[model samples]
Every structure is written in structure tokens, then in C-alpha cells.
Target: MKSKVKPLPAEQKEEIATSEPLPAYASEEGIDPELLETARVRLELLYGEVAADWPGFIARPGQYQMMQAALLTFLSAKAPEDADRSGRQLAQLEAGTGTGKTVAYCLAAIVASEILKKPVVVSTATVALQEQLFQKDLPRLAKIIPDLRFDILKGRARYVCQSRLEGVINDVAQDMLPGDMFQDAFIDTRRQQEVIPRDRGQAMRWFKSTEKKLNNGSWDGDVDSLAQTPDPQDWRQVQANAHACNGGRCEFFKSCAFFKARRQAAGATLQVANHALILATLQNESTLIDAGNTLFVFDEAHHLPSIAAEQFSYRARIGTSSKLLTSLRTVALRHGKTLPASTRPDPVAFAQLITGCTDKLSVLERFWIDAGLVSAEKDVHRFTQGEIPQDLIPECEELANLLGSVNRTVERIAEALMEQDESLSVSERDEQTRAGVELGVYVSRLGTLEKLMRSWATHDKIPWAKWLEWVEDAGGTNIDAWLCASPMTAAQVLSKNLWKTVSAAVCTSATLTACGSFDFFDRMSGMNRFPERRSLVVDSPFDYATQGELRIAPMKHSPKNSEFSGELCLKLPGLLLAHEHGQLVLFTSRKQMQACHAALPAALEKQVLMQGVLSRVELLKEHSRRVKQGERSIIFGLQSFGEGIDLPGELCEHVVIDKLPFTPPNSPVEEALSEWLGTQGRDPFLELSVPRTGMKLAQWAGRGVRTVTDRAVITICDTRLISMRYGQALLDGMPPFPVVRPRA
Candidate 1:
């Protein structure tokens, strides 16, 4: 039998996770005329202030043009009751580096928000950039634009959970529990294991030290505000979790640190947040953010697709049900006795629920193994093109139904716990509060399991891919398989969540366009869904031709060939010494990066900083220190160092790339997407592969010349630039540098 699936409508523009007229698009109605008039006047006055109030602030025509595009696009979308409308917002800008982009977007979004009466939630791809905007740029703008208020906000995990802190402080002097009492509540208990620290000395020291700072009014409870960053293991105990919070019922409610910051954020005219947290807040349905009413400004907007994919992705392990069932048995045995007889969840029912889930999970494991989908030998295997081979659809559908029933049972258990919490006597308030919070956690897990199973069984759902893969446990143990589902494109996620629902939005980035067009991004990001979308490309003011040279080495092998790593490792040391000042060698894979780092000469290794050896901050600090001491320094890094890393002038005189940054040859999602595209008669290599590689190449070269006068040479150790058919297009996409071809 065929699996039940949601069929796409004939005129459906794209496949979305939901069929509801979910959020999207722009409308020309409901704008406040008077507010727009006032904003228009403010823009003129702000233009004069930009040239006057800030030091050395040049009024680049491109910057003004960007602001104009933002204003016009938003004004065109202004409408009353936009949250319920079917309009798609269409404002895309490619403002290259050094175009004063932050200032341009801030002014435009601020003025537009004033007219639309919406908060401008500026989402960035990195915390460093978010901090830079909040600390450096907004304050500069506030000086010139009166009453321009902004707040830098992050996820609750970024703040110290006051209750958890108090608990840790109380136990600081106590000898370690039988198991060290380092219990961590995992949001997804199926896959994530609780970390057990070997020692608590560091954790206690950090807590005591932080408590002293807080008492003396030196620390503000922010993880970033601490003088010394807490060790990640130490921070885990104090990080906020939905499972731990008791809200107003807790004694610490009045002094809650995260909520105070959240309050300030909600009231601010603008909010600076990283993309992940912004998506988290929305997915969590936090009252602090009004997704439909707020105007989202996506900075580093090219990252939207990957970020959204990660946010929307769901995974469930085969053994999770058994583990959770066992945990539930313990909960009922130990804690169920505390509840009032009338309110207690029936032990029989709970057992049945747990047993049913466990049995169903076994059935799933057997089905996958029987269908030859998983192997005891292969460490990792993905479902081909995210499709359930014809013979397996029946088993998948049965598993889907079992999951739905399990989800319902989980909900009932939560409801029982919540009911008990609501009926608690004054003396039982705290105890019930804790139980209610636990219930909240179970409900979340139930939703995750149900959603993934539903998406997997729904064969014809548009743009959602499913995969089954596993990694062998350490010490040659059992392989743990993960059932995963993710949206093929982020555009649909954004369109339904941000674009269609919000009154207006502006997506700005340094490198949004790939292969000299926005079509790749447009298709991937659902920009085509917007009723009336407009895009603007403001080139960088820097003269790339005068500043940098592109040097392509005649390599004996491509990255696809086994000999490439050894050849590059041998050549990099001499090039590192030749550069003298500072250079960054970027690798496409960690295996390659670590191999090259290990193979470097002992003397040269001291001056070479490798990723994973230290924190990014420490590495940058060490690099700067070496450069300041007038010593040669080089950094060996992965794809992360390709973009958003700034090293101008002598700090970075050269950048060497070991290979092109191409998507994996067999990524299930990409393959599934390419297959779908081909069904529509599109070229996968040109449309999907080339543009992604070109953009990464551009970002890699972009690291060398951060300033207008900065001079550097970019060394690419691949000969494919002149040898392969599509190599020239990728090379052309990099900054326009003088080319130097090595003799064969």
C-alpha cells in the first residue's frame, strides 16, 4: 500500500511544510500616511546628520541608494492587519563590504519601522557581528538619530539561569554525589547524552567568582559580560532550559536575569540577534517577538538557507523510545507517590504508553534492517535521494501511525502532570512547579518525534527530504541510527514565517548573489514567492584590481584525487615562509586541515595556529600578538575562516586555499533537491553546484583584501581553474585580481 501524503495543489508555487495560507508577501494597503510623511522628513535630516555627526562618515551614493530601495520596498508593502495577509515581502540587497551597509540598513529599517509601527529585528549570521552592531554601530547612530534605542539579545542559554546558579552555589562545598550530581537535562534525550564532568573544582570556582562579581555590581549576569568566560562544561549547569524554569511560581522570578534582558529587548526600537536565536524564539512562539508584526532585517542574509535548514531539521534515534520509557518508569515509581491520589497519572496507562512506543521503535528498526536500508558494516549510510524505496512505504506508514499514537499518549501524560500542578496546595506549589516544567519538556519531545515521522511517511510533501543514517559508537559498539527530516529550501520556511507574515523585511548581505545572479538564491530562498520583490546590488568601493593578485598553482592532482593532500602539504611550508607577515590557509575539510597541520615542520608548527587547538578568540589574539611582535604567523583553518574573518593590511598578506568548497558529492538533501530540479528540467551542476562553489571561492579570496588599499596574494593550489570546463566561471567570481599562472 502507498503511504498517505499531502498532494500539492496544481497552482502551488512551491512545497511548504504547511498547507495553510501561512505567512508571505506584500500589499500596498494599510500604511500610516502620516507616519510615512514623518519618516520621509527624518531621512532627509538623517542624511545631513550622517555627513555631520559621525567622524569620517562618507555619504557614498551606493549607501543612499540601498536605503532608498529599502524604503520604497517596505512602503509598497505597508498594509493594515498585515500579519493575516497573503502578501510576500520582496526587498533584497547585495551591499558588498565597505559600503557602510550596517548604517544604511539600520537607518532604512528604523525609518521603515516607524512608518509601519513595527520593531526592526536585525538578525545576523554571527554573534561577533551582532555584538559589533550593538556596541559599535547603534551607539554611533543613536548620537545622530535622537531616541534611537536598540538592544543586543541572544538565546536564553546565553544567560545564567539564576535558579541553577543558586543550586550550584548551595552544593559547592558538598562532596561529590555518588555520580557527581552533574545531571544535565537534554532537550532531546534520545540522541544527546548528559555530560558528566570529571571534576567540579573549575565549575565551583567559576560560580563563586561570578557570584562575587554579581554581588559587587561588576557583572550583569550576561555570559558575555563576565570578565572571564566560563568553561563550557561549567556553563552547562547554569544555562537556561525550558525544563527548569518555573516562571512566576519560582522564588527567583523577581530577580530572573534572562527575562529582564528579554523585557528590555521587547521594548527597544531595534533588536540585534543572531539568526539561530531569532529562529528559535519564533519556533518557541515567544511572546517577546511578534513574527508577523516585526520587520526582520537579515544581515549576512546568504546564510538564511543553511540556518533555516538546521532550525527546521528534526532527528529521532531508534533507541530513544526505550531510554525515555525507562526514564518514565523511574519517574512514576519515585515521584508518582508524591502526587495526590486523584491527580496522579495511572501507572498502568503510563506503562502501556511506554511499552507501545518501545515496541513500535523495534518494529521500525527491523523494517529498516529488513529493507537493507542500514548495514552493520557501514558507519554512515543515507537513504538515496531521501526517498523510501517502493517496497518500504508500507512499513514506513505503519511506523508513522504508531508514532502518532505515541505522541498522543505523551501529550496525555503531560496534561495529567499539568492538571496536578494546577491543583497543588500552597505547601505543594514548588514540587508541582518542577513537575509542570518536566511536562513541558515531554511535550516538546513528543512534537519533534511526531513531526519527523509524519514528514517521513508523507511521500508527496513538497520540498521536505528524509534520511536514515547512523554512526558506530566508540569501542566498536552498536551503531545508532537517526531518522532525520529537513526542508529542501529555507525560502519556504522564511516565506511562511517571516516574509508572508511580516509587514516588511529587508535581506542584506556582502555576498548574496552567486555566479553573477540572484536566481540561485532566489530559488533556494523562496524570493520568487514574493508578489512584488525588488533587489539592488551595491558593489564595494574598494578597487580589487589594484589591491590583490590571484595565484593559481599547477597542481599534479585535484581535490577529488588522493595525491592532492600530500602535494599541498609539501608546498604550503615554503609559501608560508615566503609570505613572511601573516597568511591564512583555508581547507575544505577538517581531515585535510588536521593532516596538513600535523605534517608541517616542527619549527614552523609553533608559528602556525590551527583551528580546534584553541578558541577562535584565542587564535585571533595569538595571531595578532605574533604579527605585533614582527614575527611570521599563519593560521590553518576550515571553511569557517573563509568569510566574516577580518585581517587587513600586513595582518593577512596572503590566503591559500587547498581546494574548492563544493557541497558533498552525495548529500541526501542536495541530491534530492537536484533530482526535483531535473524533473523540472533544470541543470543541477550550473544551478546548484557552481554558484555555491563560486560564492565560497569569493569569500575565501575576500579574506585577503579587507580594506581599499590592502595588498595580498591569494594562492589556490588547484589547477582546475584553467583545466576544468566550469572552473573559469568560479575563478571569475572571486574578487577581480591580477592572475598569475605557474609554469607547468
Candidate 2:
């Protein structure tokens, strides 16, 4: 079949082709005043149209302020002429709930993008928010701003590769077993893949139906667009992946769904993406969109630091690597057969390297288990101060060198197979494609292992947290050990990869500050390094003082006491009965929440819904349903439910917090950071734990009074709120709710 991909529109083509010079107003004052006036006029027009179209719309002063802040920050983007300059056009906005931040950023970003001839990329922390923007907000905005163009940016794995789909379909139709000589070599991860389907007929039917939908244009070829969710293992067989893609070389290149989406995003004035996708595409300039020239608006921006840290982390499993190396040896030899003798890769040379690495891995795994560093009782073993054992450093260096050589050899073979060729037959081309895809997997795996080994071999000034965690199967059988390494902080990573490149960026969230300050956030996010950046704090529309009250309950024991959970069991029932409406209980630990739930009376238990019992969406829906029917409903959730949840008006009339939400230095990264701070004579408790906990507490308290009409009570059972010195700081971070506490 011929490719039926359509070309970009004439204006979009022109927009990409043209390279207009920056406007003359590139100075400390910001953009040209006339261009700024034009944006202001458009915004006023939008507000007028919205007010006329919706009778219920009530404009708020805070929303207007937020809009203005966004407008100026975005308009302050550095021009292409100043791309090599040091200063950045950045803004950190802490817009309270109900500030309408989404509309504010969208309208301002669109105007700035047009004025600057740059794309606006809005990234959110959660899929729920991303969906809300794409499905509801942007579509509505497009109706008002007639010519607005936008697209959602998803990872390649979310789309189907037509070449892979066709190959699988042909293999099934021919009755060829999976993993046979003629089969495609692009295997999914061995951990989850069931290569051969148990029910082959059913699998074939689903694949054929999916292919039909793609052909008929009923579906956009997005996995999320399907009416029914396909089995994960089955979906992996045809999922588009970077390791297997051949760009324009494949016959399906023009009609490819993933590439088509990329093209649309390239032409779009606004693109909605998640934090993970935005960070992942930074290293590769041509992926989703160029970070260097685009204007970025990060919604829920507090998550960026942690998300960036996770993205830069590396992990590899011991047992999995061993099996992967064996497979790589076979794949390299097979793919190298078609290359010229002089240029062909030597399988024996790489095989020896792979063997040495595997042997060293086995030795290390045995040594750890024998030393009780990691066993059944203890799954994790973090190196103290991010330092590996001196005795094992030499072995790690040897393994690093071995893996590095193996990766280089595999990469050579893959490059040879993937090279463009117009003289080959159809079957020969298919074979070459399969060979390239298979070798590509080994190359990626070897690269990860090589990086991991190198990290473990040396200790740097900016330390990386190194650790080992054992993986267990369903039956509690030890399967493998994962060696992991991550940067202690994301500050340097963001400073180098993100903050320095983007034309301008606006990082906004409802809870960007802790204890009336952005100090904690600035240091963690690397924003403190830029002195010229601006910040603003916008108040919520809700009247917290009149609409809600903070209640510090009398407790027999502090939350740090072992008897706290028991006290919660005794006090919670009465609180639930007194409310006689929607209520939410936020707990810091799962074990404590479960214990409190088990102790509830039958009537109270029947009225309650726990977090793990149902999906978050379903749980919130059911809570809303019961509240609407005038029935009492309570939700028991952990820290996750503290934020990113909506329960306006009567849906949540009271919120009960079991204790202060303070996380210990549990993870390797946190441990290393805490240790380093302690050595520097800094109090980690005050510098790290308090600020983070204050942010979480504020989020939990904010859930109680969500609207101006809401009359709710926030109950904190922890005695620390009144007894500890840090209590005032935590209280200052929350909304200005009236206090109703027991007499001292």
C-alpha cells in the first residue's frame, strides 16, 4: 500500500521555513510595548467572549494578576540574537487553588509564542491534569481563539508501529512459531513478555481488528484511543520504540502514527505533555519539540526536581544482564554475517568481554548475599555516604571496561544493518530490519550496564547514591538483584540540561512554597543560581478565614508515641459521626491507616472507603455520589491523596489528618543527601524534612475548604502542631483558616 500521509498546511509550512529576526526590544525592560499591547487586547477579547458565552462566569482579581504575571514572564523570553547570553527569563508562580492557572498560562503562552515565533510546551505532573488541559481547557480555548492549534505529546511507546504490526500479523498468518528463524527479533523485555500467546486465535483476532481500525481511520493509532485496553504483553509486541525505529528508511515511515504525531506537534503553537516526556526529550534535540527554542510552562512545577532526578538515574539487574549478554552474543554474530569481511564485527572478542562481566556480577551478587548486605529480611543495601566498598572498586572498573567494549561492538553491527539500502529485495530488507532492531536492544542494555558499573567504580565530588535491591517473584522467590545509581540532587542536572537552554520558562503550582518561603524549592530546583528570575504568590479566591477552621484536637499521646494509632481508633468514630457529611482521613503510613480502619465500628466501617480498595478515580466518584445522596462518606488515604484531588463544596466538609507528614531518609538519594548535609553542620530535619512536611500538610489542609461557600473543619490529631517549635512554620504555610485549639 502507498503512504497516504498528508502534508503540513501552507501557513504552518511557511512558519517553519521562515526565520524572522528577533523584535528590536531585546533588553532588561522585556518585549516591545506594542507587541505586549496586542497580547493584552487579545486577552481582553477572550475574557469578554467567555463572559458573554457563560453566564455563570465570575472574574476574580487573583486570576487577572496571575494572567499578567504569566504574560510578562513569557514575553521576557531571550531572543535568538541573545541565545548565548547568561541571563534567563524565568518565573516561579505559587498560584493558590481556584486561581485558574491553566487558562492564565495558556492564554499568555500562546500570545508570547506567536510574538516570539516559538512553540509553547505546557508540561504537567499528572496525567489527570494533562487530560483536563487537552480534553477540556484547550478545546474550549480553541473555540474562543479560532485559529489556535494544539496537540498532546506522548511517548513513542503509546503508539503502534505499523511495520511491527504487519510483521507480527504475517508471522501469525503463516503459522510460524514465535522466536522462529523467520520471526522478527524485536522482543519485549524478558521479565513480562509471553512471546507465544496461549490463545493464538484470540490474539490474531484482536491484532486484525486493530489493524483494520488503523487502516479505516476509525482510530488515531493511539493505545489510549482504543475502546478496550489491550493486554500489556500483547501490546508490547507492536509498540513503537526508539531502539527499533529506522526513521524514513522503513516503508511505513510516511504513514507512521508516532512520526505523524511528532510532525503535528512540530507545527502546533501549543503542546501539552507530562513532566517525564519533557525531561526525556531534552537530550535528543529532534524528538517531540526543541527545548532550546520553545517556551515552557510547567504546571505542578514542584515535581520537576524529583522527576528530573528519577529520569537521570540508572538501574540494571544482575540475573537479567547475564541472560541478555548471552543473547547479545548470538544476535551480533547473526547480524554481522551480511557485512563485508573487513568491516564485519568479531563475535568472539565481545563474547569474552560479556563473559568477564557476567562472572564479576555473579561474584558480587554472591558476596552481597553471603555478607548479609542483602537477604530475604533486607531487600535494600545502600552504600553509606554514596561510597562503594574500596575492596570491590577494582572489580567494578574491570566490569565497566568489559561492558563498554561489548556495547561498542554491538553498536557497530547495528549501524551496519540499519544503513539505508535501495538494492535489496523485500525479504532481505525485512531481515535486515529485524537484525537492526534486535542488535539495538543489546546496545541499549549494554550502555546502561556500562554506565552503572562506571558510576559504582568511582566517587565524585557531587556524589551519586548507589544501592542494591533484590527483586522477588510472586511466590517470594528471589529472582534478581538490581544495582541502582542516582544523583543525590537534581540541581546540577536541571541547571545544565534545562534552565540554560529554554528561551523562557514559567514554573507554576498551587503549593510551590513551604512556610511562607521558596528557599527550599529554589535550592532543590537549582533556581537559586539565577538571580534575575522573578517570583509571585497569588492568593486563592476562597475565603479561608470565614469558610474553614483549623482544629487541633486534644490527644492523650503524641503521634511519635506507639499508642497513637490506638488513640486514632478511639477518636475517629466520634469525629465521623459529628460531621454527618463528606469527610477525608489523611494518614502518613499504610500500616497505621489499616489498623485504624480495622478498629472502626460496623456502621462507621460501612461508611468508609480505603485507598487501595479501589482506584483513585472510582474512590473519588463514589465519595461524591454518597455525599450527593446526603449520606456520610469517609476516605482513608495516605500522602498521595493530600494533593491533586478535587472535593469542592459539600463533597468534603471535614478533613482529619492523623499526624504530620514527615518522611524519613529512606531512599538511597535521600540518605546520601541527609548525610552530606549533616557533615556540613546543617540540620537536615529543619532544612529538608520540615519544609517538605510543611508543603504536604498545607496540601492536606487545603483539601477541606475548596470553595468560597465551603464551611469545613480541618482536624489534626498530632500533638506536635502545638508542642513542637516547628509547628508555627507548618501552620504559616497553610491557608489563613481560623484556629480552634484546646486551651494550653
Candidate 3:
């Protein structure tokens, strides 16, 4: 069945092009003009109150106007006859960093919700902004608008499974009984380590007494947060033993934390969630959040396309057999028993199973990769709608069989482990049985993996690519190249499920427009064609001219070879040597990062906080501390350092980008996807790569100016941005800063 919705008609485009204003809805009959004016005054008053109440809540000069425009557009839709018009409304407002976008969006949502009496869903790209909205922004707004209720909606994994926890606790208790004497030595050793170093016996006694505290659902069922709990290993043991909760069917369903959280959200006026969960809900996984009549505010909307892509992508590795074998062997040793010499798990048999599966996976991966790459390399167009190559049919059949065989082998291995348990001592048998259980888990995981592989490889609508990577470990033999596949672009997956189905959506981002155009964001985000949609660009209210300086460095080397790194390494020192040192030196690649760090003088080495050496938070803290102490310091980092960093005043003075960050075309996955696109007759570079790179470079450059008071010199070492045609688009998307070009 075709989608009922079509792209915005030509006439509608002309209407928008002509800059025709939306009709005034306040005069419409049966409409409460006084009430509408009260709502408008409330919104304006709320903004004023926020600015007055918070020290940092300053609205830029044009911000009030943008907010009013958005409100008017929303109000126009609520008018009696306007509701039946069946068209999406769009408002583009560029509220700069300090302009309090959260408050503005909150006001918009509140006003609309009160008028329309429907929930508003706000989606953000990063966790930081999501937290800000929930923790700081929404709470403050809620105090002002007492009638409005809000809830944070995260992914299913965020909440703890009460039934799963109970099952785990029961399993651990049952296993501790006298009959189940066998225990893996590694598990025992791990338990022992939990005891205090000096008083092991006392620690064990204390642990036994406090074990009940672990079962109270305090851990939140989030594995990451569980680490901070006392007796983390024991907590993990409980988690591992926990059964797969079947929602309502499970015994502890009523008290399930996840369910409770969801129930609470049902009555909320505003729902806050990450982009992934939002898409998942739209895909029909759950109906907890209503999409229709909901207004979605996507913060950091730039990363939506990639995030959507990852959600719909799938990958399977072939070297899992080797890892499984090693885990089985460890289980056997820890259980105080060995596999019978005559019938030991045959490595050759495992190798055969892996090779067979890999051969099939390789075919699917290669086909898609070649199709994407060939489409790109050959400059093919209109490749989205096409059939899989006929030659790949045989390979697909082989892959199906290979996946079946692998699944069967994993099951057999698990069964063998279970059978061998009878011959061991009680303790040994228990450990062996647990090993069997572990094998069974792996077997089940493999089954799901196979199903995912089959679904992606054979699915008609989703474009897929297969690629391989080799991994090595210190104590292990060289692993075979692992094969995997994923969708060519997530937009294709989302377009089929969420975007096409949604009645209306307003996709807004600060950086949506390129040179006053929404073309880049629309195309990359897969929302380029929607007949019911409207587009707007609201300029950021930040004073860029006074807040930042953009400098184009005179480059002596091209970005193609090793010489570029050497030249950058030599030249970067000169920029840092004299500066009062809070500098963020961002490189496009690891090679350049390393070269720059290595070439620095010994004195400056102590001052250089390089990426990969420490976590981002750690590096930032150290840099902040040193910069505050009046010591010169330079932070050398890659992509993650580009944005989401807020350092004002002297804590950061210069932001240096070694080159325009672009995706490397040589990646196996990219090459394969490009080839797959090519086979389908698409221009992979323009459709997939270039626009993606353009977005990244823009984000990278955005780090230079954070707050209105923050002033820094942004040095772009890559001359290509100045010389290349596409470079203007990247520059134009950035804040309106004065550019300084060095004389040749």
C-alpha cells in the first residue's frame, strides 16, 4: 500500500516562496480571542519571567520575535477551520546558544498543549541536552506553568526489570544450596576478590549479611549503574542469573520499574526522550507515547540521520566460535573437570562451522558493498529502487543454510556441555552445567543474530552492505576477519517506518539551514520530500561577530600524505608556544593527532592533553585545572572534542582544526555501501558521503564559539574549505562570524 501523504505540492512551495503570511486566526468566529491573547501574553510573560529569574537566561534581540512567530503559526493551526486544512506547519527560529532554546520550546509546547489539549514530545540528539531539559529547564518552566506535567522517556533498557532481578536472586540462592556444590573457580575467585584485601573472612561474612540489600531493586537494572553498587560482582551474578522478563506474563510484572515508569508517563503533558527511543516507538515497538497530535522538538537534530541509520542496521561476526570455545574451556577448567580426550570439542569442527557461515555472510556483505561502491564510483543516479543482483540469489541461499548450521552447532555444543556435567563432582557438575547454560545463552544469541542477518539480507525495502574486519588479542591466535552488514543509510529505514507514516512533523535544528536554505538538513535527514511540510530558518540570536574570530591558516602542505602531519606538528608548536595556553587542537585523524603530540617539545608535552590517553571528562577537567592555574595547556583531540564542550573566558582561548573532518572513503563498510549504491545506480558520493561530511565539519567548527562572552580564534588549517565550492555551504551554516584570511 502506498503512503496516503505526498510531497508538498508545487503551489504550496510557491506560497512559501512568495513569503505569504499565515492568515490571522484570532478573528475567526467561535474562537475565544481573549483566551488566545491571554495565552500569547502568558508565553511572552513566561519568557520575560525566565530572563528575570535566571542569571544566564538572556534572550537575544530577535529571539522574542522568533518565539512570537512560532506561537502565531501554532495558534493559526488551532483556529476552528484551520485544523481541518491537513497541512504541516513549520517555524524556523535561530536562537543562539545562550538564548535559552529549551525555555522557548517549552513555552511553545506548553502554549500549544493548553490550546490543543495534547501531549508534546521533545527529542534530543545528545544525552547532555536531554538532561538539561529534564533536570534544569523543564522543572523551572513547570514551576511557572503549574498545570503542565512532564516525564522523561528513555529507551526500554534504561529501566530495571523487577521480574528479571527476582529470577536472578532466586537462581543465585538455589545455586548456593548444598546440592549445587560445583562452582567455577573464576567465579569463586571473583567472589573472593570482593572481600576486603586484609580481612577476607570478615568481608565474606559482611557480604553474606548484606546480600539481601542487593535484591531490593536499588540498582535500577541498568548494568552501567550497577557497578557503583556494593558487591558489584555479586550484582552482576544476580543480573546474569536473571531470566528474560516477558513483561506482563512474568511474575513481577505489576511492580516492574520499567512498566511503572511508563504508566507514570501516560498522564504527562510533555514527554522527553532520546531520538532512538522516539523512532523505536514510531516503528510500532510500543504505543506508550502518542505520535499523532504530538509536537516533537529534536535538539541536536543534526545527528538524527546517523542515529536512525544505526538503529536499522545489523551486523554479525564469524569469529564468535573461537571465543565460545575459549569460554567453554575456561568453564571446564574452573569446574574441576576436563573434556574427555576422546570426545573433546573439536577445534576443526568449530573452524569448519565458522568458515561455512563466513563464506555465506561474505557474499551478502560483498554484494551490498559492491552495489553501493559501484553506484558511487560510476556516478549512478536513482539507485534507491532496484532489485538485488540475480547472481546473489545463490549466495543468499547458501547464507541461509550456513546460518542454520552455525545455530545447530552452537546448540549441539551447549547440549554436549550439559551431558558431560553428569560425570563430574557435585560442585564440578554445577560449574559445568553453568558453562552449558552460558553456551546455551550464546546459542540463543546466535539464533537471533542469524534471524537478523536473514531479515536484512533478504528484505526488499532495506538496502544492506557486508564488510569484514580483523581483530587480535594478546593471548589468542589471530582471529579470522569478521563479516557484517548494515543498511546503506538509516534514512531509508526510517523513511519506510517513521517519517512516511507520521501525519505531520516539525524537524528543527539550529544548523538546519545552509546559506539560508534547508536543502542539506532535509536531504541528509531523509525529510527532503514531504508535501505536507513547511520549512523555516530562525537565525541564532548570539552576537557571533563579537563572540568569536575565524582565522584561515596559511597551509604549507596538502592533507594527502604523511608530510601533512609532519608539517602540522611543526607549525602547531609555534601557535601554542607563545599563547597563554587554553587551546583545543582538533585533528581529522588519529595519525595527525599522534604526529602533533610527538613533535611537541618536551616542556610542552606535560601541558598537552592528548585524546586516547584519558577519558573526555578527565581531559577536560585537567585542561580546566591547568588553564585556571595560569599554566599553558593544549588539548589534542579528534571528533568527540568538536562540540558539546562549554569552556568560557580563558579556560579556552583558541580552537584549532587541523583539517576539515571528513569520513574516510577507504573504510571497508563505506566502500562496500558505496559499491552497493553504485550497483543500484546512485551517486553515492553526493547522496551519502559529501553531505554527511559537510555536517561534521560544521559541527567541528561550532565548538569555537559557545557563549556570548566566550571569545576565541578559530583556525582552519585546511585550505580546501576556502578553495572548494562545497566549502561555502559549510562556512555559511556556521554562526555569522567575521572571517580572516591570511595573505598569500
In terms of TM-score, which candidate is strongest?
A: 2
Ranking by TM-score: 2, 1, 3
Q: Score every model by TM-score.
A: 0.83, 0.89, 0.71
lDDT of 2 by residue, 1-744 (tens): 332222224464344324265221113265688987887777666665654553355566566666767777777777545654334388888888877788778877887777778899999997668888899888988886788999898889899988778878887222212232112222214445454544878888889999999989998888988899797756867888786777788778899999998888777889999988888888445446667678999999999999999887888777666666676677677668887787697667767877887898887777676777776678889998788889888988999998888888877777778875568887787778766765565565567678788889889887899998866654864366778888888988888788887788999999999988999899899888887677778768888878989999888899788888888889988888889889999999999899999999998999999999999999999999999999999999998899888898888999999999999988889998999888889999999999999988988998987667888999999879878999999998988899888776
In the range 1-744, model 1's lDDT, one tens digit per residue, is 423222223233132213356322212244466765677667756766776667877666567667766765566554436444433356778887778888887887888777667788888998888998898889989987778889988888888776667667875312211111123111233345445554667677778888777657677788887766666667766777665476765666676778888877877999999889877777767776777667778899899888887898887777654466556555543455565677556677666666766776777777667666666665345554567656556655665665566556545544444443555685476544445545445556656776776777666646577777654455755555677788777877876766665566788888888866777778778877764577778757778778888998778888789888898889888878788888999998899888888889999998899988899999999999899899989999999888878998888999999887887546667777787778778888888889999888888888998877789999999888878888888876777888999886
What C-alpha lDDT do the candidate models reach, one value each? 0.72, 0.80, 0.59
- Using lDDT as the measure, the top candidate is 2
Q: Tell me which of candidates 1 and 2 scores higher on TM-score.
A: 2
Order the candidates by lDDT, highest first: 2, 1, 3
For candidate 2, the 10 contiguous residues with the lowest summed lDDT are 179-188
Show where candidate 3 strays beyond 4 Å: 1-42, 65-95, 170-243, 317-462, 467-483, 514-516, 666-669, 676-689
lDDT of 3 by residue, 1-744 (tens): 322221234464344334535532112223357866777767765665666565455555345444554554455343322334333443434444665566666786678678767677888886557767788778877775677799877766555544334434345323321111112211123225444333436535534433443456554444444444445434433333212234453345576556676788778988888888887677544566655456666777767777886666544434443344344334433332245655455666655666666566556446445555333233222222223456765665665666677667556555555564455687665445454554444454455456555643464644565544443333645333334455666656655565544423445555655544566566656664543344555455557788887888878676765577777877888777757868888887787788778888898888999988998889899999998899987889888887778777787788889987767566444665677777778888665555666656666666766666677788888877788786786677666679888688
Candidate 2 clashes between residue pairs 3 or more apart in a chain or in different chains? none
lDDT-wise, the better of 2 and 3 is 2
Query: Each candidate: how many clashes?
Result: 14, 0, 33
Higher-ranked by TM-score: 2 or 3: 2
- Residue-level error in angstroms, candidate 3, position 152: 1.8
Query: What is the model-wide C-alpha lDDT for candidate 1?
Result: 0.72
* Model 2: CA > 4 A from native: 1-38, 79-88, 171-205, 284-286, 359-363, 366-372, 420-423, 472-479
